[model samples]
Target: MARPKLQDVAARAGVSVTTVSRVLNNRGYLSDELRARVNAAIAELGYRPDGIARSLIGRKSGLVGVIVPSVADPFFGELVAAIENTLADRGYKALLCDCQENAEREGEYLELLQANRVDGIITSTHNRGVSGYERAELPIVAVDRRIAPGVPMVRGDNRAGGLLATRHLLARGSRAPIMITATDHAGNDRATAYREVLESEGLTPRVHAYGYATPIDERRAMVETWLSGRRRLRPARRLPPRRGGAAG
Candidate 1:
């Protein structure tokens, strides 16, 4: 059987195609009786409007692209979930793309989203120095990552948070607290604030930076080695050797 169309619904409802369109789109004044008849005919025929056809006419795709570094990461996962829920409430659908922190993959996803003609994009992936992003001609909201000029950005107060943490650690009797962080220029503000706070207190600031591209096990080993070295450098506390045990 042929699928039902607007013309079929109009004929079954004893109305013109214009009337059926008005009823479907809730445009113009419609009598309750006529609305009921058209709705009943649509229900009886199981007629559904084609979204793509409607979008083309309205010039609104009603779709939003969301690109993140990795949804597997808890922060990005929660952020995406919140954005999706907000978009759903606004009757917009989200097309999600996880770039997995790879720049090439991120670029590919951006192109894919543009090709799909999404209404807008919410991106948490970096696009610095990447071409084509500046030419997308779409409304883009950047989350935590800096992009081309004129692109709006949303970010947290990293510097204030870092200063607060460092001050708390100093108050808690940490003589030489160090700030450990990934070696990303995006986080330079936090490191700067940490150093500033230490300098304000007339104490030297220690910092340990690690590469994010390193494997997790290798990063952990590096951290362990740094901790061991710090421990070795600390002043030794001497205690009497045990009576019946090996002495030092």
Candidate 2:
């Protein structure tokens, strides 16, 4: 069976398609009597305009895209929940893209959002230097990640947060404070801030990288070597075992 169209609704309502379109678009220039007649015709036809099709025609979609590195972290979970609620309240639907720390995949998702004609993007991705995305024509707001030059960002001051954490640790009498950060760029920023603060206050900060090395065969060999060293460094049982579990 052929589906009904706006023309059908307009014909049924005894009005022009332009009038039907205006009512559909809420332009509200018509009398209440005509508006009610159009509404009745629309309801009787069980008609729903394809949202994507309509958006393409108007060049505007009430859709927002979001990209994040991972969703397992508590911080990201709360952020996603809040973003969804806020966007929902504003009559927009959110499309989420989880890149899982894959830069190429992140780039792919960004392009996908562009292809989908998302109205705006809220991203927490790290691959900010992709030329294709850098030149993309869309509204982008980076969240929880460093925004590249010419990109608008909405996030807490991470460098200041790092310094605050480091200073708090020092004030609490931490003789040796070590910061374990993952990414090279972000870690560098935090470490640089920590160093500047430490220098001003005659304190020193230690930083360490923590991650599993990759690339197949080389990674296996490195893991085996680390396991062997760990075994060798195990503390030896120096004294005889005590009879009681509580010890004398």
Candidate 3:
């Protein structure tokens, strides 16, 4: 079946195409009765405005691009979902790009978002080797990771968060508490906070570092290797070995 258009709604409402366009765009003040008639006609015809046409007229695509390292990750998945819902509430569409932590794919997605004329971008990608941000014309917000100098960054305070956990262990008399961190530069703040807190308490902090990109099996083995030597430590400060990662 042929799709209904603006003319069909105008014909059913007994109005001109210009009036129907105004009603759809909410351009100038419209009487209740006129609006009701137009709305009723739209409902009956099931008419939807052409997005491309509206964008061409207003010079606004009403689309926001969202790029993430991996939507499969729980943290990033929830982040993307929240962003999508917020944009939807504001009557903007989201163009999601999952780069899978690949620099090449991220760069391509950035170009594609610009090609689609997205109004703005929210990204968590590290953009390693990805260029063009220095010359990007549109607004870009980085989440949790620093992408560029001028781009605004939104992230949690690593010091405050580290204190929460480290303080908890200290209160529990976990004198043997140790810090495990990833090799990535993003984890430097947390590691620094951990070391400072331990040193201030006059406790020697034992820090074990590992690669974040290490295979899951190798990571497990590395953690196990560290825990194997825990018996030599004291009991009152014995903190149980827990599986966790700080690479995100």
Instruction: Say which candidate scores most in TM-score.
Output: 1
Per-residue alpha-carbon lDDT of candidate 3 for residues 1-248, written as tens digits (9 for 90 to 100): 78999999999999989999999889988899999999999999899999878877887899999998767655677998899999999999889998877789889989998877788999987546688776788899988777778899999997677777887898987876777664335446766767666666666667786543445577678878787776567643323333342212
Cα lDDT, all candidates: 0.78, 0.72, 0.78
Off by over 4 Å in 2: 180-188, 191-248
Off by over 4 Å in 1: 1-3, 175-183, 186-188, 195-248
Error of 1 at 187 (Å): 4.8
lDDT of 1 at 202: 59
Kindly list the per-residue Cα lDDT of model 1 for residues 80-145, writing each as its tens digit: 899999999998999999876677888888898887778999998743455666889889998876
Candidates in order: C-alpha RMSD to true structure:
9.7, 10.8, 6.8
Q: Write the per-residue lDDT of candidate 2 for residues 1-248, one digit (tens) a residue.
A: 67889999999999999999999888767899999999999999988877889789889888999887666544566788899999999999999987777778888988999999999999876654544556779988887665566788777777787778777876896544555554555435676766555555544544544321233465456556655664565332234323332111
Q: What is the Cα-based TM-score of model 1?
A: 0.72
Clashing pairs in 2: none
Model 1: lDDT equals 0.78
Quote the lDDT for 11 in model 3: 97
> Could you tell me which residue pairs clash in candidate 3?
none
Q: Give TM-scores for every candidate, taking all chains together and pairing residue i with residue i.
A: 0.72, 0.71, 0.71
